[model samples]
Target: MACVTGKNSKPKSMSKAKEWTVEVENLFRFQQAGYRDELEYIQVKQGALIERWPDTGYVKKLQRRDDTFFYYSRKRECQDFEVHKVKVYAY
Candidate 1:
């Protein structure tokens, strides 16, 4: 819901989660050693947390690791589960 005016507009609590995403926006600022002569295929990395899940326990992060990529965190069921995101940039 974009906008809410009712009393129940918000939830009582939220859950932790890790989300991930991919994209290519900027390349001029992208500097790669392996792709110095080639163009940046696409970069990706950890991102931010939009919202928390109440049922599961997890955390979220959103960020741009490269000039043309982004990522998010996802909620893991296991407490010891390590969330790792990889970015593939083809030269």
Candidate 2:
């Protein structure tokens, strides 16, 4: 599946995440699944449900573009070094 940004508008601003928060962690998973963020994922997938850990609310699974699946752990998956790799997009 092609990555879609809705109307093709670019993010108003973007920055590398400095810390690992629940939002950042979810964004990391979304990016890994070829989406710019959760909003884009919902738009592209047409509101498909995203499975999450009930207690911690962390992302538990994601479906990739090729119709494959990616599973994440309940614990933090974005390591310290990898925090910089997660992008925060504003539109």
Strongest candidate by lDDT: 2
Q: lDDT tens string, model 1, 13-32?
A: 42222433212111111222
Give one digit per residue, the lDDT tens place, for model 2 in 17-82: 998888898898889889888777677777789999998898798888788999988988888889
Q: What lDDT score goes with residue 89 in model 1?
A: 38
Quote the RMSD, in angstroms, for model 2. 4.5
In TM-score terms, candidate 1 sits at 0.18
Give the range where candidate 2 is weakest over 10 consecutive residues by summed lDDT. 1-10
Error of 2 at 79 (Å): 0.3
